[model samples]
Target chain A: MKRFATKLLTAVLLAMFLFVGTQGFAQTINIALANNPISQALNKLAKEKYKAAGVTVNIAVLPENDLRQKLTTEASTGGTSYDMFFIGPYEAASWAKNGWLENLEPYFKAMPAAKLTAYDRPDLIQGMVGSLAVKGQSYALPFYGESSFIMYNKELFAAKGLTMPAEPTWDQIYDLAKKINDPAKGIVGMTMRGAPGWGMSGAPFVTIVNAFGGKFYDMKWNATVDTPEQRAAWAMYKKVLRDAGQPDILSYTYNECIALMQSGKAGIYYDATSIAPALEGAGSKVQGKVGYAMAPHQKMMTNTSWLWNWAMGINPKSSDAKKKATFDFMVWATSKEYAKMSVDLDPTGSSTPPAARTSTYALPAYSKTPYAAMTVKALKAMDFTKPTIDPVPYVGLQYIAIPEFADAGTQMTQFLADYVVDKITLDEAIKKTNDVFNQVAVDGGYRK
Target chain B: MKKKNDWPFILPAIFVVAVMTQVPFLLTVVYSTLRWNLARPDMPIVFSGIDNYLFFLKIPDFTVVPEFYSIVLQTIIVTVVALVICTVIGFLFSILLDHPIPGVNIARTLIMGPFFVMSTVTGVIWKTTILNTTFGWYGVLAKSIGLAPVDLLSYYPLPVIIFLFCWQWIPFFVLIILAGLQGISGELVDSMRIDGLNWWQSTFRVKLPLIMNHIRVAVMLGLVFIVKEFGLILVTTAGGPGTRSYTLPYQVYMQIFSASNVGRAGALATMTVVLTLLAVNFVSKSMKKNNL
Candidate 1:
């Protein structure tokens, strides 16, 4: 019995080795996606399509921060764990310069059909792709682009006899919020993200600062946030968020704001345009009584609505064969036909690709949706020319450029959080943010 | 002749230990001293020496201190608080369960349910369901009681996290101490009773003395758990409300992943390791003295 058992174990080991060897030759694409509704739909579509193509696609859906952490770790370590990743323009330029991403210029050129040729790349509304590309090589493909807008409760506005314009000023928005705010009835005048992080609080703050004509960095990479424009913007934002926002606004992210607006607690939600579809869904309590308008501005009409959300990128560490497979999969998955298939499967219209393709937006399917016309108008009306009212060198709409921006930005964010929590003064926070980053710049061999 | 085969006995163990601990530890030490940004791995990893360490120390956010000192303070706070709370609660419950009661085992097992939960899940459940200021169940209850809802996160983050840590770990210590309690020969209690010793006196002089070693072991284990706790902090506060609850592991995470300051992050990790070693040594020395 012992001899037979030993023989059986040997046979099993040999068979496993052979199976692994065969499987090694088989092409498998490892795709990492953000844990968003649209990405979930895309994963479901990729599984079916990749299976038909005699390839296996392993998908890992992670939250925004985890996805960033994992992808950054993998890319930096030159690990080939992910063949394709859903990234954003935030790290695209820096990652591309670091040679962590495969330049998709050649691939896109080879497959002209996959490229947005006749779709007018310049008029795509969000010109983040231009910012993401270095010299002439496109590093990451744009899956979706977004800008901020004001989503308000129409019924509450009507009840309060408030009149909000198609494009209102900051003062008007503040007055409207003050009028509609009824805390006794469990309604807040306004709700925006006040969570202390670059992505959470800083994104909207940057836009407001831009509208008020703030500049983060000067011509020579010196810290320039102590300007009058920035101080005014920061002061105003703190006042509004503190008063009209939920008591727990300090912890609010995009999802929290969405919940606030959808549940009839918020009179106005200033956030991403992508939330319009979600807000207009059948499950939403305040669906039909919602209105969309441009992001409120101050002295200038310019407000930077960033091209945010996940985009596909190829891994630089992958083998040539793996790269080809990844590129092919990206093209196939992001193709117009595939998007249509995704929409068909998930008819909520949440699965449709948020692209700049005029042709795709002009589709009868997209046009039939209530959000289609407004979404198109919002996309078309976005101004990339003047991202900031004040002069600055970088092109990022919602963030500062430079590799050290993450660290410096986080330090600044913590300072702001402290100030808001009354741990420090706003003037003290400003001085600290500017001085710390300026010293860091000097230390990193840059003139400040 | 028998000693010649000792190499064979130790080879596999050595290999496993190296793979699991030594290699990664060595890498962390190397990365901590070098200007190695993972996003730009191709760039020649420059040797910045103690500059990264100094820079992290001087990081002008809230406080100015060496990364080593900051991590040591945080590690002590988390471990010490968790150790005291877990030991007190665990010992109390273990005595309760030592008696003959109907459904006692069921009650004990239900209390241990938190030990079965993933740390991340624990953080998420607490943050969203129980501790959420506005819409959470806890908030709803608070509002129903005609009280202004409390943002448990804003004012009381560290204490709530400590409570969570204690809630999860107390059951494990209970299980350990219960086993120790059961092994304390009944004859000792009988002898105490014959001597006319009260329950409190017997527990203090007899039962407690016997379980000192077990208690030490539980404290040591709890120390290790608290030292490595990052998931809860990361998920719940992300080390927030202005860095009040930032622990050693969470600091390392913020430095490495969040700030992408890998060199400084490495310095933080090295400091953490040194502190963990010192803590373990201290615990073991105390345990040896107690045993003596």
Candidate 2:
């Protein structure tokens, strides 16, 4: 009995020592990334680098919804499901405010030379880096940034004798959609994301609302859903979706719209500019025939372009070692050298995510690509300093920077979807959506 | 020895059930009473005394009364519709495949295929492959057949979702009822046939009543499963069409995850648990009455 007890104790101590030793010697970083082409490439690149450094990176590649759910679950629970994660500006700001993420400012400050080389540079597009701040805190680092744009089939335009302007308006896009639509040939005039998610649909909706001079909240953070500008925007958006867009558009997300465009089924696609590379890839039937332009406008281009990207955010709950390792990988992965390496590795150019660094655009290799000028122009035009026309008590390029925004935006998307499906008339949908916004405001103590 | 044998038959199952369900359920109830944000620095759980509940209730746009009621009503409508449709279709198909048909096995396999598909994948397939307005095969076929494109999701959302749910669920009903059909004593069926009643009469009077227990189990289980369904609603419509199809579980998700109001979310969850219990009691009571 004494011998058995002694043996058991020895085994337990051995196991504990093994765990600590392994944890100390080899830093294992868990990265939760969204399942996009860019993310896939990033994962592949990350594994190679981390493995070479004797670090094991457990990559949880999940669909966008699943990734968000898992990340949110882990974040909310204060669990260490991941050491590093991919987040966007909206999530970074709102989540950082909630203390859901580790502020990277301190780490960046600690490694000034590396940070300067990677993030702070004239060569790195100032807009991209500038967009990563929330309440004057650098919460995340941009891996890639994008503004929404209109990608049209130049062949279809030529065939239909339709002319696309240099900077097209919503009205012009509508007309073009009508002219080029040929359902008989399985071609639709346009495809836009109408799916019910803040990221999927709300991005475009914000742009539309902005173009119509519809501020979600007035300068005082008062509800503006019932405003005529918003109503007009909703009505116009509904009309365009009904007439020129694909059927069951409310089901379409970024990937679905991209598929529609790549398959030559869509004459126009209004979505994130990051899709330009995918659309220009060899697998795309419309590869060489696609043209890109800025997102359509109705009034002024207030927030016509949405600034969105997959970004690295450090987990607040991570151990110091884990945090350091995550920051190391993030800095390296987002570095100019990494971007060049990615481009070199990606012979197809589709795998390399468009990095936010201006040096990436300046690279002779990137400049010579099919999407070079248009993508860079769109990325450069991603102005985070001014997203909404009217001043509001928030900071987000394409989203309202509040914790309640996700819920409110989702509900708002559902209302917009209702308009698309013709379940409710434009007037009714607007009223209902306004009611939702007002209710949210009241509950949030933003209004009486 | 007999008493010793009794626990062996039940102990493992009880243990499994306790671990898998009862504990988590208790945890959820506890979680319902507190303000818990997963990502806080300290992970401090605050007791809000139903403040979250009141807050969720007071959100003018998403107040509990109209929205929750609408969601509940929609769920009931869809569940009932799916139940009737799946039962009828399943019954008919079961009868069709009972004996020998050239492609009966293949048809059976195909029917079961949708059941095996993950809910998210099924939603994706239905949304993109069939109901997609632009490149969906249905749209392509509609155009090919000289019909103007049908916006299935836009024009027919609830029915489309209900149809997809029913379509997926029918195979279970068919398979279970088929098992019940096969289990019936041949002598009893033969004796019934000897009485000179036609096939329909035999089925309606004897066979169906004999399988009433099976139907009760299948339909009630179906209802429970259907009512608790979150993935389909989450993936497909997300309880939209202006919350026309919003169900209880989807509402809970929207409240907690979307709204970030843990208190309100807990209240909604507690209410749903109460409602579900009430429903289960009503179903079981009605089932008992029918059995008696």
Off by over 4 Å in 1: A1-26, A47-51, A109-128, A342-348, A368-374, A380-386, B1-19, B40-44, B58-72, B283-292
Query: Alpha-carbon error at A154 in model 2, in Å?
Result: 2.3
lDDT per residue as tens, model 1, A1-448: 9999999999999999999998888888898887665677777777665543546778988876677778877877788899986788778878888888899977766666635553344543346576557886778777766677888999999998887898877778888888888766778999987777776787787788887778787768788879888899878787777767777766787778878888987898888777776676657888667888888878777454554756789998888878888887776665667656756765656677665344556666666666666666666666554577667766666677666666677767766766766656888778868886786567455573
What TM value does chain A in model 1 reach? 0.88
Error of 1 at A420 (Å): 2.9
Candidate 2: regions farther than 4 A off: A1-28, A47-50, A105-123, A134-137, A301-303, A379-382, B1-65, B94-112, B290-292
Q: What would the per-residue lDDT of candidate 2 be over residues A52-167, giving only the tens digit for each residue?
A: 36467788788676677678767776889799868887677667777878888788678868557645445555566666666667778888877878889999999888878868
Per-model CA lDDT versus the true structure: 0.76, 0.76
Consecutive 10-residue window with the lowest summed lDDT within model 2 chain B? B56-65
Q: What tens digits encode model 1's per-residue C-alpha lDDT throughout B1-292?
A: 4676578888889999999999999998888889865544445679988876676566555554433465467668778888888998898889888876999889878878998999889999988988786878888887788777866676676787788888778888998988889888889878988999998988877898899878888888888887898888888877766566688888888778876667878988887788788989998897788672
Q: In order, what fnat does every candidate score?
A: 0.44, 0.64
Q: In model 1, what are the clashing residue pairs, if there are any?
A: A76-B38
